[model samples]
Target: MKSLPRLSPTSYALLGLLARGPATAYELNNIMQTSMLRVFWPRADSHIYSEPKKLLSHGLVSEEKEKVKGRDRTNFTITAAGRDALAAWLAEPDAATHRNQAEFMLKVILAEGGSPDDIKATLARALETTRTETRMAIAGIQHIIDSPEAGVRKGMPWNGMAANLMADILIARLRWAEYATEAAAAVPDDSDRAAKEDIGLAAYQRALQRLQAELDP
Candidate 1:
């Protein structure tokens, strides 16, 4: 649809925001954390601020100068070029399979001998997040199935598929979290029994650091 380079998902999400309405950085941050971005791309605020510049440089989005309460706030708007680029990206065939990186699992594996209560807290928080995400994902599936364009073959079903997949993943995660929570709560602080279950957390952290170091350098 448009002559455009491959952009990261961060770039697409940013463009999608401007595709809807002109928004300041704060508004973009809210959208990223609250909507589709929350369900998929969990990114930093600084990254969000930097992407508009990249999009603007590529001539895919434009910025409007706006002032709020006497403070200069630049509101970004996606251009026709951006819409075209997004359409092309979506229309393009992407058969490449992606890998999963479960950072939370890494953290959980590393939480050996730390406070069991703290471990419980972490799992509980994850449980709540998983529940919320799964609910939103189900809603997305409903949206896709109800679309008038549902019968046609295109990129729309991908979101519905991903959303369903995420729902399943979240459900599995919640089940794991329950067992993890129970395990953490059941551990005796005076004993190193859990540590003996497998590789102690100290050993795991040391290995993690070495891996991190190797990757960093």
Candidate 2:
């Protein structure tokens, strides 16, 4: 009946993963690298290691220490309170925001002095990376959606829905990356703000349309 303390989204991510089962920080990192990283790209391993302790302090999760190959390992499991809190958070509107602001701003700043060719190369690499990550994410999500256990989870279709959304977002990102690759080449060395804005706006509108189509009810 107590109100859950407002915590960072990272805390809920840890709790949600633990709701499935107990996991050491290492295992959580592996899970993130495999799946969660597609959705929450910027979290570091250090944050994973530290977050469970915060949840434990709040009585949302409990931890136990074990000896693993002569070293100590701490594994965390969600408490009932954690499950309740996670459910409550999920029912609220998602507060997650895109992580591209600083990178995009830096690109704009660098366009003032950096060579167009260099910028093109950077976006080219990003496009390739997005392609690779999106492919892997689709495969992973499809695997989950195909699994029989997916329906038996408490969250059921929402987990499947979230996976579907991730795939859609990645596809949208791929579109934007492709557009960015072309626009980077077209950008003039003078850093024409209007031209850059036009390029970005076009890419954004395309991506938004794709996402909106997926979420249309």
Candidate 3:
């Protein structure tokens, strides 16, 4: 099979969502607003509308036109080429460059220049958002556990695992936000490069420990 041209992570995101089902640009904007997409890897709605043309250039997706009450209605569909590309992506290692968009680097990068108060405020806003997400994720898991989907009605068998994964991710992010908030608050404005290196090193060690614990076999 001819290799489909590589697409941006955002383009891949659009194609992957389309693979689930045909959607209008408006519907996709709604999807982007609710999930982790809404937070870490947020894409503007305009990008969603534009990527389809690029996907079309690469033979990845198609658009269909309909009329709703005398208005033009355009819906996008993933093509066979798109499905093939998505499958190839899923089979590869997820340790890709796209992971850095998570915004955690803001704490370390913006350690200086801005007023400490401003840095604190930026982090506070992000922390509050993550905390709310953490709560929503917890509530969703509770709702699922209190009544299994299969037991309740016609529902997916493997969906519980997906929900659990989401809950675990949000919990991890919440813990990170909590820790970063404190760490950022601890460092003073006049700290020199050496001191900031120490902070970065300490964070790296902690992350290493966490990874080791998770990967213990």
Best by lDDT: 2
Candidate 1 at residue 119, lDDT?
67
Q: Which 10-residue window of candidate 3 scores lowest in summed lDDT? A: 148-157
Name model 3 segments beyond 4 Å from true.
1-3, 36-41, 91-98, 102-104, 136-165, 180-217
Off by over 4 Å in 2: 1-3, 93-105, 108-110, 145-155, 186-217
TM-score to native of every candidate shown: 0.62, 0.73, 0.65
lDDT of the structure predicted as candidate 3: 0.74
**Model 3: per-residue lDDT, tens digit, 1-217?**
6866977778877777887789888877777776545544677778777777888878888889999999998888999889989888868776654354645456547647667787777777778988888787667556656874453322245455556666666777778778878888898877888998898899899999989998993
- lDDT for each residue of candidate 2 in 60-156, tens digit (9 for 90 to 100): 9888999989999988989989999999998998657666433753774576477777777777777887888877876766676567774334356
Ranking by lDDT: 2, 3, 1
Better of 2 and 3 by lDDT: 2
**What is the lDDT for 33 in model 2?**
62
Per-residue lDDT value at 42 in model 1? 79
Clashing pairs in 2: none
